[model samples]
Target: MMSRLRITEIFYSLQGEARSVGWPTVFIRLTGCPLRCSYCDTTYAFQGGEWLSLDEILRQVASYDCRHVCVTGGEPLAQKACAELLTKLCDAGYAVSLETSGALDISVADTRVSRVMDLKTPSSGEVSKNDYTNIEHLQEQDQVKFVIADRADYDWSCAQVSEHDLTSRCEVLYSPVQGKLAPRQLADWILADHLPVRMQVQMHKLLWGDKPGH
Candidate 1:
């Protein structure tokens, strides 16, 4: 039997986060994650998903007729087959991106896939899990995200950005943890610090109020 990947959810919707926010995109949320960040919103994706082969996933994605595809997870990189999935998507001629927690070795991922890596901040509790080596894997097309929950997290993220020179490597994004830090407060901090990183809100959360598979 051909091996298949465990998938938590797959749907077509507007890109609700990162630099691609608001763009029509297809989301492939894979199951399982090793880390449990304090403010994790998609904890539901941790378990209970159907398994599907790469070809089957592509067929389903093609039915959406959208060119932009985002393969995300509870940490999609945790599954070895995710790399294969990304390769297949690129071979199929779709603009693909992978949203991953920066805790994994991303150097093995296909170069054609833009990596949106999440660097956990101090407040996330999973901050120690960040594999700093992933920083070297970033390219201009890739992006780094820091979800800040408060002033401490924001400060830590700023330090990491400067220390890693992430702005030159890829687009840096700083987003406030919903209901934890006010968006306006985070915006003001970004401005005051003169940080080059882009400030973003969870656009889907604003629209759907934490609805799943959005």
Candidate 2:
């Protein structure tokens, strides 16, 4: 049998987070993840999904008629076919982006696809799973995100930013863990440190209050 991806949800919505925030985008949220971040919001995606071939996924995305596409997950890279899916999306002329947990080898993903890698902070409970080597693959079109749950995460993120000279490689984003770290507190911390990174709040969470598949 030909293998297909196990997808938890596929929906059309505005990009709620990341550098492309506010753009009309189609989201393909695959099922399963290796790490469990402390503040993970998509626990629903950990199991149970429909199997879909790459062609079928592309067809569904194309039906939206939008050029921007985000391939996200419960860690999309956990599925062996994800890299192929990304390449196919790029070949089909969509401005594709991959939202990964920074725990997988991203070198094989299509060069045209923008990679938004989430580097787990100490507070996330999955920091040890981070594949630091992925930092080498980041280009200016890519981004690294740190979801801060407390001052420790903020400090660790700041150190990583300077240690990697991440500002020179790609855009860096700092987001507060919803309900754990207040948005204003995280913003204040960033401002106090004068860190050269973008501070973001999940627009979907702000607008729709973390409704599933938003």
Candidate 3:
């Protein structure tokens, strides 16, 4: 396992996505991702980043005095040290959560940390990268998110939810891609079908308007 991780940025922000939305949280955004999703906003994290040891990262997170810590990335699991970081954060008594692209093996993540895994839709252009096996590992505290861009994406996401009985396993979230799909339309569809999923928008975006490092 790596003792150090290439980090893009670490800052204090409200949890933007997932079940913990709006909670004050420390965000550790790691650098590098293997897939290129078209709607990707943090493309800056694809390349350069600073390296930090696990202890250094922990210290930085603790300095924020935040009880919730979210480990995110251009795919944080791309780095081997991420697994170690999550375990250490949990050991320190912080409520830890991981936001992964769902293309990597989440089986290595610390059990104490809640996982928010994404199932890439066809519009993301990285759909083929979705690792279906990760679904089996999702615990009750874990969640699945689908960033839907249009009707087609929403339909496909609904199918996956049924095929996997996603809600029965954990929380399932359906979020519309800003600008591509209207939030109201997505919400209507969800209500129309009675899909067992939570629909949310990026709260930070509403407050910060695409500001970097919020």
Clashes of 2: 0
State the TM-score for model 3: 0.98
Give the Cα-based TM-score of candidate 2 against the true structure.
0.97
Ranking by lDDT: 3, 2, 1
In order of appearance, the predictions have TM-scores of 0.98, 0.97, 0.98
Off by over 4 Å in 1: none
Sorted on TM-score, highest at the top, how do the candidates line up? 3, 1, 2
Worst 10 residues of 3 by lDDT: 1-10
Q: What is the lDDT of residue 185 in candidate 2?
A: 96
Give the lowest summed-lDDT range of ten residues in model 1. Answer: 1-10
> Model 2: per-residue lDDT, tens digit, 72-116?
989999999999999999999999999999899988789999999
Assess candidate 1 and give its lDDT: 0.92
